[model samples]
Target: MKPINRRSNAPVFWGLFGAGGMLAALFGPVLVFITGIAVPLVLILPADAMSWPRMQAFAQHWAGKGLLFVVVALFMWHAMHRILHSLHDLGVHAGTALKFACYGLALLVTMTAAWILVAVGF
Candidate 1:
């Protein structure tokens, strides 16, 4: 009989992790500093910059929906990857079950974000 071949899903998750890490490094802090803190305290960017109407309008756009979905999904996959690897150092010893749990949660969030984005309409 021919040898069996098994493919690992690690690369896909690693790719997502790298992309998300880059995104987070590049934009995450600025976003938090600007929206989470500045918008509330700085009195700089105009309070309405992140207002519901503006946000809703952005979400209603195709590009905005794509950005939102990619950001949410990639960040989630990135976080899950980190958590899975961290477990080893913490003595949790990542296993198949743990892998499933981590990746499964990422998949769930991705699906949910996609569903919501689609429902938001164009």
Candidate 2:
């Protein structure tokens, strides 16, 4: 039997999906609590926990920009990966085109987020 050709790029997308899933799991609940529960009730976190000026300051900070960029872009990657696979499962076998669309959209979002963050200026 000839040696199998096992090389593939699935690892790259899988890596992004894993990382994004982890980040989303870690932060998703906190965000929901803050925006969905705490903020609405104004009982746990302070009323101004996410007020405009405070959020503006946070977004303008370099560290905060980095965090936002990572979270947004990674989540986009995760979503795209999921969508691409789901399309395949649904009988859409457009291979290279599908991969390009999904990953390209993710790349576009990532670059846009980075540019906006940088432009916002601290």
Query: What's the lDDT for candidate 1?
Result: 0.90
Top candidate (TM-score): 1
- Model 1 lDDT-worst window of ten: 1-10
lDDT agreement with native, every candidate:
0.90, 0.90
**Candidate 2, residues 1-122: lDDT per residue as tens digits?**
97879897889989999898898899878878888999879977899988989888999988889899989999999999989988888999757888899999999999999999988889
Q: Could you give candidate 1's per-residue lDDT for residues 10-118 as a string of tens digits?
A: 7988999999999888878987898789888856788788899998899999999988888898889999999999998999998889999999999999999999988
For each candidate, give its TM-score against the true structure: 0.88, 0.86
Q: What's the number of clashes in each of the models?
A: 0, 0
Q: What are the clashing pairs of model 2?
A: none
Instruction: Please report how far candidate 1 places residue 96 from its true position, in Å.
Output: 1.4
State the displacement of the C-alpha of residue 53, model 2, in Å, after optimal TM-score superposition. Answer: 1.1
**Total clashes in model 2, counting residue pairs 3 or more apart in sequence or in different chains:** 0
List candidate 1 stretches off by more than 4 Å: 1-7
